[model samples]
Target: MPDTEGHPEVNEIELVDVFAALADPLRLKVVRDLLAEPDGVERHCTSFGLPVSKSTRSHHFKVLREAGLIRQVDRGNSRMATLRRADLETRFPGLLSSLS
Candidate 1:
């Protein structure tokens, strides 16, 4: 099996965490934009164009990652962010769709 050490497994992701992560408007917008992407697409963190400062944007990404709402990877000189669609779908079917 793949490592689930540092990140949440599908079953470990809680609705509360998801809800909390989505509670912020900026974070919700990030998630919305991510979900709108083609499957497997990863956008650079800075490309999201969020109004927050670098530190705040970093914090948003961290919260989303910890809440199992997104997956972030360091690519070259920048971080890439992508929605954890598969895991989220498996854990909470129709949740993302309902949010749309």
Candidate 2:
């Protein structure tokens, strides 16, 4: 099911993984904040109001990224996370619409 070359049906992703990634309140908040950040303000994982330890926060972000709920990129010294808005909309229509 990994998005490998052989997997021509990469778009046939499961809803369980996607739903699981968005299940957390903190993760939801992260997405909400990312949408609000100004055009160029790439929010780091730590910028989220996650009360857990850094390790836990990292875990949450990883889950979201792996499930395609968010995108993470490494900038100079920090990792930035942004919502995969269009992709998610195409894959699961009305998914983000209900959340917002």
lDDT (Cα atoms) of all candidates against the true structure: 0.86, 0.74
- Which 10 successive residues of model 2 have the least lDDT summed? 1-10
The lowest-lDDT stretch of 10 consecutive residues in candidate 1 is 1-10
lDDT of 2 at 50: 92
lDDT (Cα) of model 1 = 0.86
The digit string of per-residue lDDT tens for model 1 on 1-100 reads: 2235235777889999899999999999999998888877999988889998999998999889888888888788888888989899999999999777
Candidate 2: misplaced stretches above 4 Å?
1-12, 37-41
Name the top TM-score candidate: 1
- Clashes per model (N, Cα, C within 3 A): 0, 0
TM-scores across all candidates? 0.92, 0.80
Which residue pairs in candidate 2 have backbone atoms (N, alpha carbon, C) closer than 3 angstroms, thus clashing?
A: none
